[model samples]
Target chain A: MWHDRAMSTTGRRVGRPRAERRPDSGLSAREELLAAAAELFTVQGYAATSTRAVAERSGMRQASMYHYFGGKEDLLAVLLEGTVRPSLDLARGLLAAEGSAEARLWQLCRSDVVLLCGGPHNLGALYLLPEVRTERFAGFARMRRELKEAYGRLLADAACCTALDAGEVAVRTDLVFGLIEGVILIHRSDPDRPVEAFAAATADAALRVAGAREEDLAEVRARAAKLAQG
Target chain B: MWHDRAMSTTGRRVGRPRAERRPDSGLSAREELLAAAAELFTVQGYAATSTRAVAERSGMRQASMYHYFGGKEDLLAVLLEGTVRPSLDLARGLLAAEGSAEARLWQLCRSDVVLLCGGPHNLGALYLLPEVRTERFAGFARMRRELKEAYGRLLADAACCTALDAGEVAVRTDLVFGLIEGVILIHRSDPDRPVEAFAAATADAALRVAGAREEDLAEVRARAAKLAQG
Candidate 1:
């Protein structure tokens, strides 16, 4: 579910054996904590979840959880960061690549949609939590801003976008970005809906919103398909 | 903030007077309770908010709250419905109105963006709360689906949409509806955004996603302007 699970992949911690068995999900101790927090926060409301509950869900003692995360917020910060950082990485690569910015933009949107919709829990929806808006989560907020900026950059460089004024480009970027994150609500309504199709349709809509030409739409799809491969 | 405030506007509940003075916001007692619940749920996490807290916020005793709502879930149910029902009503009217379906669709999307962004609390975001997914809120979910169908009908009738198959029309409608609800995240990041401008650009992008021809966009906007007046 965690297609974006990245961070501190280290050797397992040899903690004192506990009665509760943690499922061998192949995630490291820190990743296990993040996974547990993601599940608990989304399934049960965040405010109702305690750090103790998170630790228990991850099969660790409350004291032992501090070894990985400072508390619940830290776990949230990492998960939020995890979601954006992968998309940001892909965006940077796409921006540096030589293909038409149109194709790369489509590819970027497609991949970002997959990431947002990929996870078991709708972790992307967590961005709306009032807690995530606080100063404590500023880093996650900044990374998200950077990710949006990457969208803007790819979108701005697309030949179709050249005709747009600065304000228009910014507005289009906002809408395009909104459409990508917006899928969380759509996917929730039909959880069984295939992520691949959902991601593709959203990415296509994003390109359309960014002013991709109808005549060139197939070319954009072809080039994007190529980029996805290599 | 309450541009969509409707429901049981049946006069003030003449309960035993409470000690605290209620603000003269020109809203009915039931409206006051709904407003208080909306503010508390969005500002504080929903699970953390107590009906007592909502009652106190509205300057009423906890005992008096039951006169309006059964409990916290009821308050949430009303708030969620309030967010969608107005838009659904507008969509239904737009569906029945005589005019280009394109213009009506644009108008519906624009008006919805305004409603979602106009509120002081991001009540639309409350739709993402897992608790709302429970059977208790199925009524609210049905209202939202009805609204989406409104979008689909107008979209399916749009001249530009005639070329596509049913699946394509459904996908475009999904993206268009997604773009409208998706604005909550964008507006949250820039709360200062002018809803009118934001709404217009979004409606335009929605039309674009719905396969409205470029040649017809200006016409759609012009007709939508007239519809806005009459």
Candidate 2:
């Protein structure tokens, strides 16, 4: 799942399966610092969390943490790039196909829902991280901005292909994202609701609100019915 | 304008109308504490920012802050109530009237958009507060669940009144709330965007997705077009 070529650094390994299987052994200290930072920032938050805490958590000396990442903000930049860049790249590639706008959007929403929910915890931690919004984390903020733009472009393309208005596209994007967020919020509220089920419901709702044609609606109902029967 | 009850909480004055006319001295110490807590939790992740920092920022003794809020978790509860309760009450009030599903939903969405944009900064800040997800602020979490239920009931009623499918109602509510949150997020990111424009777009888009009849759509379009032209 790791995309080494995705990194522009000259010496970085590209498509090396061995490197991905044992990143702890393969990654430069900088990469390890970022992984550690992502976990800490997501769990303890950026402000209350400190470099020393990250160093201790990652089993490194505090001074080494500083050498790899100038400070907490730089670690945030690295973590955000790891989380957001590949997600957008994957979305852009998946969305670049000929299909019904409804179908294309369904595909896109599914990918996001999976990314958000297919974890021990939802990606809300990353999205809601305080550091990402602060001036000190401007690099991460820029990445977030670009990610949104990329998603918007995908939605706009779907709208054009499907004959939906620009305003409608905005509505569709908001509904899909909000539904995903809401489901994750609900899952966090009650762990009993499997994220996958909610993710499926979210994808269904997203396609339906995009004004899926009758055939598409019937297809989804059939799927839901099948799930019930099975 | 504040509700009469809210205004009365501070009381008019012990003496005469002349004294009441004098601006209430800047935020009371308690008020400053709440405000500081809200801002800190919003700007820094709740886990990252300490109650001590809030106290220091507000220039109040940390122990004194505990007197008002009890603890950091309690502070989150108060912040959410300050932001969420009024909106739920307003939504319930709007749902009480008799109208077609479209009209009723439009009213709720309109009010929600207005309320959301009314205090853009605090609204987003209060929402993405990290502590909100943890059970540490159960009261605040209950308020959110109740708010969602209130919105859900209104959507269900509209579905019954308009003859829409139950599934469609679920989808519509998700879509409507999505538009509300999305508009708020957009306006927060670009504070210069006129709140009125965002509200109108939200209302119109929601109406469209809710499957407003041609007559109702025409009415909304006319009103929206006039607003835009003006």
Candidate 3:
């Protein structure tokens, strides 16, 4: 009976062959949709972008778009999730890893700067959109808070390793995030700079903002190398 | 002949008495309009705010509002001018003043941080609105560039004194601005922090980002005191 049922299912199935399944651009349908949405949302403000426009840009029928996202807000939620979640995971991993707080913080900053500079458009810039501040995008805000808290913890740890006080640690954490986010604005104004150089400079600035002592820097750099190796 | 004409006009024309001319709030209609527009634009946004809404908020009819400003864009331009022009003037003043680059840079950062933190809504945050990036605000962009260039020069001078290379100086200048703008973001997240403390911390972080030496900070602080006296 089981064999008969399995045989019947094989005969009735009408799936596209594996060779024809992938799109010419090689992005999955969901990824293509996200890529299209990110482009439109970045170039044109999210309020002006429509589901139909996203579908058209993705080379899919408007009807098929619904299969991927519930609506426009969902599309944005997904796009932000794609950008924020990985960083959050990495931050959590770094926080747990064995290394000096300075090294861990440096690694986080370097990786984050790379991510901010990696994309064609800095997706982190989307956080500045007024629409993202509304209740509809509360999920994005929550994830952002988690990322910020991660920064706060790393900063506090770094402060402990250094001689910085609690009050200053709180302030420095915010400034460090700002310094990282500032790279996006700089990139927007002058996109010609090499990303690697920008990332390295931003990472070094972040350490400096945390009040890293000159003597500890050599040790931090050594630890940073080991952290990178992992 | 001029005195005779003025006397005749004063005697014949029914001008409101000086006391009657000024409003109970002691603001002219134009000033009242600007104050109202800043509040509305900061709470809502530029595109979402309407001229009629601004007029209503200002306790004037739409027609009367038009007498002060041509339209909503003009209202925003005036508000931005009020914010940006003063900072630009201060930057120019600092650039012209005689002092070590560190002292001049410190003073600019301290004063700018105060301005960014002084407002009820951190008005500098308005610069991040996507609508503000459009052609209508090219004047603001130009002023911002002048401000950034001032920062670049000061940083380069500091780097020269510190023995940092040209590439490092370029990187630090962008990070310094980022550190300052980060104050606005920090204020938004935790509005309870004392503005004085935030300003102090930001100025210190900025100097650190520029690679200020421990031995030189005391001299910079002394010059900052002298600069503040004026």
Candidate 4:
């Protein structure tokens, strides 16, 4: 079935590809459409991007574009989900695992930053789009909220964060989570920067924000290194 | 005198205000135009916002709107600068004043966050708008660049951060600065959030990211408190 047919850098497909005049991205049509949308939305303002433009840029017929996504909003929704789903999955696993809270938190942050900055486009930056606040994007919003709460959980449980009361924990979570999300803006300015190092530094900064002590960080770093290897 | 006119929550004005039907923002014509543009561009979006619409929303005649700003891009440029100028001014003062780097850094971070989060609208959020990357906003971009360098200088000079090499200092600066810019998004989500407490927590988190130790923070906090009152 078309739905089960795997595509690289994209999700499910619905209908047959347009046989003629498609972009030779080697990606499936759906993937090409998303790639086109990502570039247009990020480079130009989203409101200025038309479905016809996305279709044209992807080198497919406009009608065929609907086979992949309902319209511009659908394309945006998938792009957003692609950015968050990986981080959320990792966060879920980190929550269920046995490592120290500091290690797990650090791992989640490093991994999440890597995923966020890893996209072909700086998709994480799109989170600031005003259209994202609407009810239509609520699924993406819910997933992000769960991901944030997971960060809060890992942070609150960290041994180093124990001195913080509930209010302090919430505030730190806000800052740590903000730092993670915000790094994308900085990252986008210099997209060629090495991701692994950037991710590691961002995670370290996050730990500091969570009140992790310096002497304790070496142990947490070692444990987090193991988590990365595993 | 119009050029020297300093309107509250805004900046210099231009040619005579429209004789009739301007927005009762108690602001000068230029300030009113900015207020309207800030609201519409963020709520709706920049691409979707027309200069005429901003003019209409500001309660000014379309023909006379040009008497103030050159166009939509001019309106945007002013709004962007308004967000950064106060923070930049504060950073300059903090850099010149005597204190532990930790305390000055903390004070700058807190006060900057307040200015950022304290905006009539979340004007800082507009920094991500793609139009900002264009050459037209170069002045605002330069100011922001200088502001970031100020952050790096403060971070690199901190005693606790002494062990960090130059590269690590750069990375920490990115994360801390990212945390600061990124907080506007979080602050917008919970617009009712108390700014002072939020600013303090964010500043503390920023210091941690800069590698300030817990023991050092108490004195830094005291010194920062004095800076606040001074």
Candidate 5:
């Protein structure tokens, strides 16, 4: 009976047989499953990854996994929402912050870099699943549109603050984001290269283009100085 | 017997064969297959693209495609080598040209953007392909490493001409490339966006970050004036 109780329990035992687990908790089994799926999906392409693999990573039974996520697509939806929505919110907040346009824009870019790199592995398993990348994901298109508008607004604001024009802002925003994302590809291709170094270098480079003065801001200036020293 | 003779004939026959006969040289048919495959591979990814589908798109037999390129991987290699190699060589030539570092570097950047955007559809296709991206394809790693070194060298030269340090060159190079490639992604993602606008914007932004001014040279002055007027 003790063995049976221990077998069914995780961390604590409840006097129940074949229970469906707790109905509510912080990051329940379902949320955990989705998290696992997101990590796996981003690292390995979706077709290469499997539900069983996700279950293994999550330390749960395959049958129990289905009970939480239903299927791959459902799991994908949840993972996408969890991974992107938060970052999107962060971007919005940073862009909407009360500061000089350049400062707010800098914050927005920094926040995106943080969100993209702050994960189990940088950017999580989102890239692994191309299905969400395509036109099929329910809100993916809308999300992309919103993101473009937000970025555009941030650029416009930054330009206003920096005394740059719309054209200049558009170019700067495009290039900065590209370097951040583009270096991700390079880092992934060459695991030997330090992702942190690339991220720092690229981030500093981007800020320099944004007119970050070395004498004005000590922290970002220091980072840029280090990269320049390199 | 006459039909077989006509079918085996190369180039345009003296008589018409459009309605009742097929060409003998099969060169046109082969070219069509290559074009179709490149298009599909760019959009859908290599793993998802099939030989039969490529053949159908080309209006040729799948077996005939094998005769031309051996297999799909060979086809892909041809596309990469055929398309990207020439452009890369051109970029190298531009970078290596004898001039002031700033002049050569500017030429390299401008020519790179031009060569990369050589075709309307294939500009970003290489980056999109799974087989071609992330060091999966043969020669891609070596090519990428060489490209990086070349970029480093060009930046070093720029710093030397500008009397900046190695570290400064590194930072400047990162920002310059980041800005250029980043804006390229923006223009590519939205076809309606003017390419010239993107190019000028990126060039101007990079020049600004590099501390370039009208006094730099007559050419820089000319380009800057063009951009300012635009």
Candidate 6:
């Protein structure tokens, strides 16, 4: 199921040859444009960021950008895709993997935090920008909903052993997402902290939000370790 | 301390005459511009929202808006102040009022959620816009930090009796703020739910984030009730 969803959504063939893919370090014109566009969009915002500025930032001529992207909106679409696709792919993989629900959630939370914090800036913060909420970005919104639903399913599974009902599960799922995303906001305020610490703390907080009992967290942590090894 | 900070920051005299204040219904042209600007800025991105549009939306001439605000940036500053001042005042009141730290934190969380959800759009979300994070809005950022400090103080006081240490209190403070702010994001995704229900649930979830033990939650809820009555 995960493989089917990933392949369909991203249009990538299964087991594609890595040799055909370009590296992310501005080696290709397309990747260079994307890297430059992401920085500009995040710093100056979507409405204020222009394709011309993006080209200049990428050390390419303004006219060449049109060959790569049709316009500014297309650049933004690609950037949003860059942010959402990897998380969705990881979520699908984890949801399909064999492990207890608690352990799976821990893994998801940790990886998500690492992604949000490992970036040059808190790129996740880009989602909160007003421009992204408009109709043109409806696809980003849909992808976000898919990620939330993935969290919802894992949370529901984890809550099955506890006294939490369906309604509680739904509310807790949203809160847990907020807890994870909140780390990005915190990093914005204090960026000097270690990313590993934030990831570990967020995973622990996610478990608590999912209603894992204190005594049970030890076992859940052990399971997470085993899952990480696999 | 809270009172002093709030008063100095907002620059309003205590016990000011109500008659000195302009009514909020656009009865005054300045109020009209503010109302229209808030709606426009919340609906359209700030960079996309023009002062001319704000004036047209308010049924005034474009030149008339300049009498109220110098430009679009000034209009945004006013709109942001409108969002932050009321909450700062409320936080100050709650901090200065008589109650346990737990009860005050509950009141703050519940009322903040109510304010965020009660608006036609999630005005609290305006803070997340990339445009708002720039140098022009440094004052807004400082005000936001002050608000977060207010929350931190309350959480620290509440955690005094618990096993939570200084670092835990700080982490929990950020998480609780995120949980509270997340309500706005959730409401954006699912606005049909009752505002009161979201407020109640958020308040409960905040207490959980602040390290309230299950056994202690009953008393905290009772205190919240008493605080609400007063």
- In the predicted model 3, the residue pairs found to clash are none
The candidate maximizing TM-score is 4
Classify candidate 5 by CAPRI docking class.
acceptable
The digit string of per-residue lDDT tens for model 1 on A65-180 reads 77666788998999889889999999889878997998998888888888888888889878888888899999998889988998999888999889889999999999999999
lDDT tens digits by residue: candidate 5, A39-156: 6765565556688898777667676665555577777766555545765786677665654554544544554555555555433323333354465566854664566567667666
* Two-chain DockQ for each candidate model: 0.70, 0.24, 0.39, 0.73, 0.26, 0.40
lDDT of 6 by residue, A1-230 (tens): 22232243467554321221245462566677777887887677777888789988877677666656668877877677666677788889888997698898888888888877786755766665566677888888888789889999898888433677888888888878877766656776777878887687778767876766656777887898888889
Candidate 6 chain B weakest lDDT stretch, 10 residues: B13-22
lDDT of 3 by residue, B86-130 (tens): 667888998888868888898888887887778666566566556
| Candidate 2 wrong stretches, greater than 4 Å | A1-40, A58-71, A94-96, A135-139, A159-187, A190-192, A195-197, A207-230, B1-29, B44-74, B133-136, B160-184, B203-230
Evaluated on CA atoms against the true complex, candidate 2 attains a DockQ of 0.24
lDDT of each: 0.85, 0.57, 0.74, 0.85, 0.55, 0.73
Q: Estimate TM-scores for all models.
A: 0.90, 0.69, 0.84, 0.92, 0.71, 0.84
List candidate 3 segments past 4 Å from native: A1-22, A61-63, A159-161, A215-219, B1-25, B159-161, B214-219
Q: B128, model 3: CA deviation in Å? A: 3.0
Candidate 4's interface RMSD, please? 1.0
Higher-scoring candidate on TM-score, 4 or 5: 4
Give stretches of model 1 more than 4 Å off: A1-23, B1-23
Model 5: residues >4 Å from true position, as ranges?
Answer: A1-44, A50-64, A77-83, A120-135, A159-162, A190-200, A211-230, B1-27, B81-83, B118-136, B160-168, B171-184, B207-230
Docking class of 2: acceptable
Give model 1's docking category.
Answer: medium
Q: Please list all clashing residue pairs in model 5, or write none if there are none.
A: A41-A128, A42-A125, A42-A126, A42-A128, A228-B167
- lDDT by residue (B1-230, candidate 6, tens digit) is 22342243468654321222345562566666777777777677667888789888877667655545668877777667666666677788877887689878988888888877786666666666677777888887877777788898888778433677888788878778877776666776677878887787778778876766556767887898898787
Expressed as tens digits, the lDDT of each residue in B71-128 for candidate 5 is 7877777676654465467558746566555555555455555545555454344443
